[model samples]
Each structure stands twice: as structure tokens, then as C-alpha cells.
Target: MRFLSSLLLAALIVEQVLGEYGMAHFSDWGNSKGKDYCIFFNSQWARLPQDLSKATRLQTYDLTSSVLCSPSDVPEGGFPNSIPMVMRGNCTFYEKVRLAQINGAKGLLIVSKDRLTPPSGNKSQYEEIGIPVALLSYKDMLDISKTFGEKRQVAMYAPNEPVVDYNMVLIFLMAVGTVALGGYWAGSRDIKKRYMKHKRDDGAEKQDEETVDVTPIMICVFVVMCCSMLVLLYFFYDQLVYMTIATFCLASAVSLYSCLWPFVRRIPFGKCRIPENNLPYCHKRPQVRMLILSAFCIGVSVTWGVFRNEDQWAWILQDALGIAFCLYMLKTIRLPTFKACTLLLVVLFVYDVFFVFITPLLTKSGESIMVEVAAGPSDSSTHEKLPMVLKVPRLNSSPLVLCDRPFSLLGFGDILVPGLLVAYCHRFDILMQTSQIYFLACTIGYGIGLLITFVALTLMQMGQPALLYLVPCTLLTSLAVALWRKELPLFWTGSGFVPPPIIMEQINCTQTPGPSTDEPPSNPEPATSETNNQREDPTPATQEEVPHLTDASNT
Candidate 1:
């Protein structure tokens, strides 16, 4: 599933027919007080005036003839000051509203069983009607009928939804902190890479060796996979959600182990290894503490999977694991140069925009494929959601909750795509001795980009392709820093600061023929390509020595 920014996740969950949300305050006219259930008011009709003093009286039309097409269906004197609830279908919304209005109904509540849409009407029809029109789901209608038999009063008023939810603050902190910390960690490790190499023994050495430096070719293939996987999930969500969950469980467990290994190694007590055995991969004497840590990480992921639906506390665990996963990826997947970083980030940028924006047109539901899959398919039988995103519950109570989207989401890709670049900057700074300037600039750029994304989210009210903003800001800021410091050439290629090769001097000496002290006379050593090596260490003669000096360039 795509990890996406879902500030207006309401687009998918809350289909605001008129781009407005209202709470259907249904109550007994006699009792005078009751619960308010959320409902949508159509923009085509008279908009609710937000004055609770004018509640429409609720009356159900005859069930058998629920379309209420005929004036005969109107009760004796008609619904004098009431709004009649009618079942959807069999007639146009305008026809239903007009018939209800002429029969003395104050408004119309069209109970719909399908997706919510506007009680649409032409401009001419708009002037011919005087009552409000709204949609109430069949489920809400049944609840109202069962809760209070009849004589119900309902008010439809749109409340101003708070554009800024407190959850945004939490999301900001989490996103910024995770990206910054990962960058700093990557840079620091790079600065001490040589020292670390000397200090690390068996397990740590293996861990260091496992990190894969990103390459230009690897990057293209990776983006293609991201696109393919996202599409597959969108199409086969039911079939793949299980595999996604299981993959996450396994992957997160390994990532968490990698993240924790540094700290675990310091424990000293767990450094002891088990005796050798022929039991498959572990036959090479594995560390006992490593095994224990592995089990704990696996346990956490499985626990999250089991209680994945527990909205109360499960999100905390998921976010914690997700952050570790991001950090682990930052460390393990090395970006070898600024060129590779640019290629990876830019390619993924296009990938995210295509999936999130362009796919809506291609989708039958008119919902973006990234958003549809990210939110979980509406028709899935399992109701299982992918746990790859960072989700935080909305901290305020608003009418928006009626949409069932109480959480704001940021996908792992959003964090990781930029994070990988930031990690490269840190390594760049440390290696080039630039005082972390590149790292800081890119990280700050990322934070600023995220801020812009949230702003777009608030104003536009839709899921945004985060990488669109993140890539430009990060890549440009880093490029600017390189230009300002006059290190663009070195930074772009990742050369200058790398340790010099010990054997290169010998090779150079052999290639360059200095003015001959003994005179290139005698036999001119004429044709001796082997004299290049003897020119340096003049005492070589033994077999091992013979191999060393003879064509040492090739050796």
C-alpha cells in the first residue's frame, strides 16, 4: 500500500456532497433532546441556515409507496411543518423534493443505501424549490426509527470544520524528528567508519558488511518496483494484504534488530556465542543475545498484527516500529554519491505524483489509486489495513469524524525517499569535512517541504504527493550548498575525502620514468617492463619477491 499524506482523507471517507458536513440532530419532538448523528446537506437545495431554532419535523412516508410520487401519498392536511424521509430510487431527487415541498413538507431527507452524492438538480429546478435537501444513510434512518418511534425533530446545520487539527502538530514533530535523527546517525557513523571498523569484531563486522550502497541502476529498478507493487496492491488488495502484513512483520523485525544492534552490542553480556552446530544458517555460532533480541522484535510485530485494529494503543506501537524501520533503512541502504541520491529521489518523486494524482482518472471509482489503496479498499472482505504508515488520531472532536477517518497518515515512502537523500548528505558532510552543512541544509529543507505539504493539505483538503515538494526543496538546497562551498565536483562524485590507496604510489612510481641516475645506458634495461618494480625495492630476488616486483602493476 502507498504511504501517503492524507490530511483530507475525508475525500475518500467523507464524500461531502456539497463540500459540507452536518450533524443530523435527531430527537423526539416531545423529549426535546437526543444524540446528533452526522449527515450531509446537498448544495443544490436551500442550505441549512445554522439556526437550530428551525428544526424540521421528521415523518416517514408510507413504506410500500416510499417514493411519495403522488399527491395522494401526502397525509390528510399534509406534513405542515415536517420533512419527510423517503427511500432513494424510482424518481429523480428534484421530483421528490418538488412533490414533498408542494405537499407542505419543510425539507426532504433522501435516505440512500449507496455512496453519498449531491441531490443534484439543474439551475432552473433550483428556483422552483424552497425546501432543504439532505442525504441520510439507510443505517442512520433505521437507527432513528428504532430509537424514537415517531414525532422526531431534526436540525441540519453545517459547522465550520477546524482546518488545523492538533494531530498535525504531532505529525510534524514525528516526521521532522525521525528524518533529522536518521540523518545525524548516518553522518556520525560515516565519520567514524574507519574507527568503527577497527573496533567491531564478528557480528558487528558482518552487520557493517551487509549495508548495500545504492547505485544508479539499482535506483531505477527500485522505483519501478515501487510503482509495480503499489498498483498490485490497489488491484489485489484482498489477496496481497496478508502478504504485505507478513512481509512487514518479517522486515520490521529484521530492521528493528539492525536498529537495536548498536545498543545491544554494548551490553557485553550478550556477546557470547552459542557452540557450533549443523542446524542450517546458524551453524556458524550465533550470539545468544542476538537471538533474544530477534525474538523480542518478532513478538512486537506479531502483537501489532494480532491487535492491528485496536485503535486505542496499537498506533503507538506501529509508529515506533515504523520509525525504527525508517532509521534502519537509512543506515543499511547506503547512497554512495550525490548523483545516485538525485536519481533515486527524483524518480520516486515522479512515481508518487503519478500514483496519487494521475491514477484517479484511471480508476473506476474516481479515487486516486494511491489514496484508495492507502485508505484500504472499501470492498475488502478482511478489513485489514497495511501497517506501513505513520498514523496519529485526530485530537479534536469535529463533525468530520462522521467520515470514520479519525487519523492523519504519512507513508513510509514520504519519510524514506527524502531520508535516504538526507542520509547521503550527512555522509557527504562528514567525509568532506564540511561541518555537516549539507546534512543540515537538506534536513531543514525537508522540514520546510513537509510544512508546505500540510499547508496545501489544509487549503486544498486532499491527499498530497509529499515527494513533489520534498524532492525540489531537498535537491536544490543541497545543490546550492555544494555550489556555495565550491565542492560540487567532489560532492557530486564522492571522491576527495576517501582514504588514499596504499598501492597506488607504487603503481605511479612504476609508470613514471624519472631521469636515470645510473644512465638508462648499459642494456637500457632495454625492454625490461619488470625493471619498474626493481626500480623501487632493489633487493628483490626470491620467488615470492620475484612475483611481487615482476609486473607489480598487474599484481
Candidate 2:
């Protein structure tokens, strides 16, 4: 997952820069409605001129320097007092049309202000700017000039219609999502490998403790800076707000996942280490690939953050702390420390899919409700306001592309799985066969958390402060716990040693001594060299244990 993440980061950088630059420099379409090509003309038969009358017709042409060579070409510009040169200005067609109408002109005639190659197809450059405007092909303008001398009378009627483009938002969101998934998959793989090694070494074994030489603190600084810059961009960059937000959200999600997953078992911090005993040990090969991949993820995250802002140099310091914590969690997770990290990854994936796609779609669709109060006139002079109940959209269609409408794939059930996982983790060591009752409690508790997070984010997006929504979310977590009371004690007790199935079996059978007067062992031993030598030339069966889980998780 780590190597793949690096490849993905490289791809993300290339894809985004190329797409943005290419579209900006080469694509004819931009956010500028003032460009003649973006306009559309609508005229009736009565308004059509005698020579080239057409009704409800759509024609296209190129607008560039080559087509705007002379003033005589425009029928309206042919008047002796009138002159037509490319009129260059910065404003949308809507603004320009209003300006032209206010100046008492029948319509505005626009030609290319910049030199460029002609566009292809039946596309016409001339468009009716929203009020009786007329579009002209260069050829038409020239013909009008030759037949009627310098000027000809023309009229237009434009409307207040506006056009919207969501391409940028969609592109940015996709890029962010891809990068996030890459980071998570990569980071999780590394954690998984470490986990397997820890599991393998739990038995009788003695080995030298590996020295901690790497400076994870430095890497954390890099990642934190990246996250801080992304947050700033999302808040400050108005035009690219969607892109910035998407990037920030995805990066944060990945970072949290990377930092948390390894500790899914939640072993105490600063306690994990190689154990030593008389029994033989078998340590699987260290996952070099996962380590490299993790390093790459850290690098990409920091680099991206740095490039976004530099004065944020102070912000970079945050990554160092984050890196330290990530490394600690990474190391601890390798042992059968806690299931919390695993559960965290699962939770993050849940949040990612829903937050990025579902929630947005729901808000857009209006299936989610809001409350509004309005006063009606109170007397003969004023009516009384109606009772407020709920504010819902009349239709389910959302303007945003969040809910893959018509394809409606995910739903309330999807949210339940992760909740069940969390419940199961908390209920560790508990044995209950009552599926119906257990499932109902799980569903209700999970549903509440899901709903609370959804509402909190929605309110936050709509300008509600963190405190306002956070208070409610705290209650929601508390509720999930309260409703699922049957599982708590077992969860706490089960933490003694929740190893992998194989390791748990070995511990159960061997009757190992309890850690110093009832305390659990600080760390399990890694495989001894003697075991490695015995297994060195063993059949592929032994080799199978080497790379399966880590390799698969990374991919």
C-alpha cells in the first residue's frame, strides 16, 4: 500500500497540474461568459433579417484576431461614425449586455481580443448577449458591409439566463479521493505487516531489541504542515474553495488512518518491545516494502503541504509531532496491542465515503430536513406566520453530483457494518448468541452516531460553529455507549491479550506465566535466529507466512 501510495501521489501531482494548466491555456471554454463563444442566441422569425432570416437556429463560429481584422465587417459597425475593432474588457456577457443596453445600443458586437486558432465544427462565435443581441460570423459582417456600405441597423433582445459549470469541483474532488485512498491503503499495509511480526513473536523466543534510529518526528512535522496549509487554502481561496476543501478533507482522513490503524488493538504506549524467553521464536521477514511505502506517504503529504504555503513554516512544525505520534502508533500496532487502530481504519473508510459523497448528496437532495420559522401578517395590515414544522425540498434531486442518483447504491445498511465492528471490538471476549436483540441495539446506536455526524457536518458547512454541533456529537457517542452496555466490561477485560488467532492459540496452550504478579507482558519476543534457520529452507508453506497480509493490504 505504501509503494502504491507513492505512485499515486506522483500521479496526483501530474494529473492535477496537467489538467488545470492544460485546460487554462488550451481549452477555449473558461469561466468567462464575456467570451462570444460562451453565448447562445435565440431569435424568432419576425426578428430575423430579410437576407439571412433563420428561426430557432444554432450556429457556431470562431472568434479570434484572424476573424476581427476590419471594422467594415460588422453590419452595426459599418456606420460612418461607428467603428469596430476588437473591444477588450474583463466582465461576463451578463454584465456587458446590461452595460450595452444602458448605453442605448440595440446589441453588443464582440470580436476576439486575443489571437488564437479557430475552433472546429458548426460552432458559431456570435451569440445573442441576453437582450435582442445578434451574433455575426466574420463573413456575415463583411457581407453586410459590402452590400450596405459602412453601417446597417440591427436589434437584439437578451434574457437573464445564467450558465453554470461544475467541472472544476468534480475534478478536484476525484483527485483528493484518489490520493486519500492511496495513503490509507499504503499506511494500513505497513501496520498489518508489523502486526503479523508481533503476532509471530508472541511465543517462546529471545531476540535483540531493534534500535530506534529513525527520526519520525521530522516526518510528522512535514505532514502536519501539509495539513495546516490545506486547511488555510480551503478557508481563504474563494475560487478554488472546493478543490482546497477536498484536498484538506482527504489528506486529513488519510493522516488519521495512517496514524491510528496500527493501534487497533490499543496496546499501551511505550510498552511494546521484543520479548525474550526459552522457547524457539519465528519472526517473519521485516516488511521492507511497507516501510518504504510509509516513508513515501509521509513525503508526499509534507511536500504537498509545503507547496501550498510557506509562511506556514510554523505550521510545518505540527507535522513533526504528528509524525512522532504516527510512528509510535505504527510501532505499537505491530504488536497485538489493541484493536482500536483496526477499528479506526474501518471508521475512517466509513467517514470518507459518506462525507465525501453521501452527505453532500443528501444536503443537495433535501431529503435531510432543516427548520425554518417565518412570520406571516398578524392583522388586517399583517398576516400571522404559519406554525413551523419542517423545511424539506419539494423534490429529491440534488444540484450536487454527490448522491449518484438513479444508481442509489449506498444506504442506512452500509453505515451499520462499521458500527457493528466497533461494537464487536468493544464487546471483545463477550459471548452472546442473541442475534436479534444484539443487532437491534447495534443498529439503533450506530444509526444515532451516523446521523449525528451527518447533521454536525451539515450544520458546520452551513456556518455553524464547532461548539454548537460538537456538543451534540459528544452526546451521540455517549448514547452509543450507553445503549450498548452489555459489551463494556468484556471489552476492557479482553484487552489483556487479543492476539491473532494463531498467537492466541499458542498462549492458551502453553500456560505462560502471567506478567510480574498479574501484570501482562510488556512485549512479545520476535522470532529467534534458530527458528529462522530451521524455516529458512522450509517448503513454500513456511514462505507463505512471509508476505501474504502485508502485500495484499498495500495493494
Candidate 3:
């Protein structure tokens, strides 16, 4: 199920990249207003034209440069030309566009250098070009050339209406639902198998000792990290995003190695001992291939994050990779119990609500804390940049690609908080020797919660604390299911809330002893029956008994 989810996530990433980079079609040409084809051109910093559709009728004209610079070119009219012009040349984009603008052209179209690749040039050079401009692929340029050669009149009109792609939305929803169902089923099956095995082994094996208490240390570390991250997010968002991309790339590469460690160990490496117990442990000198792959991923991430302008494919890849790493960590780290999960969710729920909603009210600006930070380098005057959030591009049928618009976003907290509960439920299922239905329920509930969040966001057209919906859905649904199965009492007393070993020992010491085979000696002994019973039953003791046990063993 995890594998399936990973694959689906990859597909979604690819779709986002393609949708953002892919070209919109010139569906038809007519005098009447209908669809105005959207085009992205000019400098990286340039904004889309707002009034392209306002023009009633547009005439097309083939363009040529008067100056010769490259082979297979002809010199033609230069300045004082009228009408929109299409030019095919190897000259720099700024030079050609400048010349066309001076010649009184209403619009400009540059023929691409190759059939598949779009024309490459510095879009930011000629910001003052007061005309609509577009780059045509080689094939498109040729088709337009043929149309002009046949003396056919070319006409263009602005789009009258925009449409929504319901099909795409439905597909995305279906994919998410499938992942939820599949994960639930798989977890349930595995839990049942484990439960049967545990039942067979129950009487023969001793229960494990209670785990150590690391709560204090964990809390301290979490608080420190959170404080540091918040500081960075507020002040150095862009730099932080770049660093995060690089870090996630490196981390994901390492995680990928860990996931494939089993297969990796099987590969023959002469005279080197593979550590079976400590998998994914690097040798004194790691394999060249591993180092190279890691370097490559890091390089790509850094390069993309730093250099790509207005090209959101890089953001999609980085965000998806980060998500994959987080999902992997969630699967790997087992949470201790249901109580722990509940406590975590409760704390995070409040944390999320405060950061998202209350922070604005507290601050003088009355702006959402997260939204202010997520506004990248372009939006902020500080010139800082960061990709701290994951965004999924929303697809619509409108010819105008709203790439610049805000996308569907999930904060890091939204994922990590609920994921901890899901992981805990998995561990709890194993500890109780029960079907994994609890984990499955929590996962599905999380998905449902996210769906609700999306619906609310759509209706309200505002930012929401995802945990507001997620926490209740996951906690209540899982709790209700546990209650229905008569597991609530067990959860409270047993695996869900096991007392410390010291307390357990103390309780045992105070209780009356049961019947034992060893009889009291026919001599003066300890006055208490508790001592006699303890001697007879010979049950294992807590850490407090370690010193006495050592002395007895030495003697």
C-alpha cells in the first residue's frame, strides 16, 4: 500500500510539472469573441497581460529582419511596418522583439529553433515591449508559414468564457480514495496475521520489559527545533527554502538507500562484511555509485531551486520528494501507544490552530502567519525565498493558465502531526495482537479530513488550519471503532496505558501472594508473608532488584 501511494504521488508530481510547462492550444480562429489563447512570453519577471481579450480583431503579418547575421535568412522590411508580425531568426529575443516593436507591429511571434523545444532567450531583457508576444514551436511556425503562403486571412479572438476540468478533479479524488482503501486493507491483513502468531506464542514467551522514558528529552528537542525553524521561516524564508530543498534531496537519497538496503546487501562485494543488523549502514568508504547518485540528486535540487524562474516544475519535484521522505519516516518510526498519539495530536492541534488563525489576531498586521511567510521572493519586499510548504497545482479547462495563482497547499505540520498518530496506531495494533483496523481507520479518517479541508477552502476561499478538521476526524473515528469492538477497556488498562515498571513492582509487593510450591522453613524467618511469597513465586523484579540479583549471582 505504501508503494502504491508513493507511485501515485510520483504520477501527480509529473502531472503538475507537465501541466505547468505544457502549452495551451490555439483551438480556433474567428472574428467573434470566444476563446483567447493564453501565452507566456517575455522576461521571467513579467506578468501576464490582462487585456489580451479586449481587442476586437487582430491581423497577422509575416516578419523578416533587414540585417543579416545567420545563414538561411533573408532581409526584408525593417521600420514603419504595420500589423502583427511573425519572425523566424537566430537573433537574440530582445533584439528581434525590439526591432518589431519599432516597426509599429501590434504583436510579435518568434519561431522556435527546434520542433520540440520552445524558443530559448532572456525574457526579462525587453520589459517595455508594449505588445502581446508569443513563441511558437517549429512545427507551429511552419504551419503558420504555410497558411500565409496560401494567402489565407488569419483572424484571432479573445476567449469569451472559462471552463473547469471536472474530469481531472474527479481523477485526483479517486486516486486519493484508492490509496486510503488499499492502505487500510493491507494494514488489517497484516495485523490479523500478527495477532494469530502472537496468540500461539503468548503463554510460552515472557512479555517485554517496559520501554525507557525519553519524553522529557524528546519534548526539549522538539521545542528547540520548532523555535529555530519559526525564526528562520519568518526572516529568511527564501534562503531557508533553498536549504530545505537541498536537505530534502540528500535525505531522500539516503532514505531510498535504506528502503532498498535488503537488495543492496545481496549484491556481491568481495571481502566486505555486510552488516545485517544495522542495515543501510555505510561502509568506511561508501560505494562510488551511491555517492554519485546522492551527489546528483543534491545537485539537481540545488540547481533547480536556485535557477528556475517562474518554472514551477522544480517546486513540484522538490515538494514531492520531500513528501516521499516524510512518508517513509512515518512508516519507519513506530509510535509507542494510543495515549502518546492522542497527546501528540492534541498538542499539535492547538499549535496548528494558533499559528494559522490566532497569530493574525494577535499581530497588528492581521495577516496569517503562514501566508505571510509562504509569499515567496517576488511577493515579499525582503527578497527572501523559501519553499516551506507543499503545493499541488490546480488544473482548470480555461485557456489562461493561472500558474501564478496560489495553489492547494498542505503545511508541514498538517502532515507530520496526523502521521504520528497513524504510526502509533500501527504500533498499538502490533502490541495488542489485534487486526490493524485502528491504523486503517485513522488513515482513512485523515484522508476524509483532508477532503473536508479542501471543500471548506473552496467555499471560504481562505486559509484554514488543516488540523482543525484532521484531528477530530482521525481521533474520534478511531476511538469510536475501538469502542465498538470492545477494545476501549483494554486500551485504557493494557497496551494503551501501561504503568512504569517501578510502579508495577511496588503494586505487586503490596498485594497478597498466591499459592506457591516452596514451603516456609521450620525456623525463624522474615515475619512478613510478602517475603515468603516473593521467595516462592520467584517472579522477575524491576531495576531496583538489579543490585540484589547481582550480589546473589556473585555469591
Best by TM-score: 1
**Pairs with backbone N, CA or C atoms under 3 Å apart (clashes), candidate 1:** 3-411
Error of 2 at 150 (Å): 11
Candidate 1 lDDT at 25 equals 77
Off by over 4 Å in 1: 1-21, 30-32, 40-143, 190-205, 271-282, 399-403, 498-555
Task: Give lDDT: candidate 3, residue 205.
Answer: 20
Better of 1 and 2 by TM-score: 1
Order of candidate numbers by lDDT, starting with the best: 1, 3, 2
TM-score of model number 1: 0.74
lDDT of 3 by residue, 1-555 (tens): 233223222211111111112222332243333222223353232233334444324445554333222322323554233334444554655566566666665555555443222223433554566654555555555555554342222333223222334433543353343334333332333334433443322222222211222143454455445545654565576556555545545555544444344344355553233343433534334454444445655565556556534445665564555554544444443334456556656765675567667777765545545545544422344343344345555555544443233244455456655665665565456555467777778888988887787666655545666778889998898788889888875553224323457866676655534346276444334435656666566544423332210021221
Candidate closest to the true structure, highest lDDT: 1
Candidate 2 runs further than 4 Å off: 1-86, 90-95, 103-191, 198-555
The TM-score-based order of candidates, best leading, equals 1, 3, 2
Better of 2 and 3 by lDDT: 3
> Each candidate: RMSD to true structure?
8.2, 20.0, 12.5
Q: After superposition, how far is residue 380 of candidate 3 from its true place, in Å?
A: 3.0
Model 2: per-residue Cα lDDT over 1-555, one tens digit each: 332222212111110000000000001122112111221132421133321122122212222232332333234423232212223234433443344444344434544222211111111312323234333334434443454322233322222211222332332232223222322333344433345454433432222122121123423442344334323422233333334324442443355445543553244433243344454321433233333434555665555445533322422333332233223222222212113323332333433333333433444222111110011111112111111001111122222121111111111112212322333332221222233343244334444543444344333332111212222332344335534665433332223223356853564434444435477544434334434444465454234433322122422
lDDT of 1 by residue, 113-201 (tens): 76454576667898898888877777887788889755667777666667788888898899889999987887677546633444657
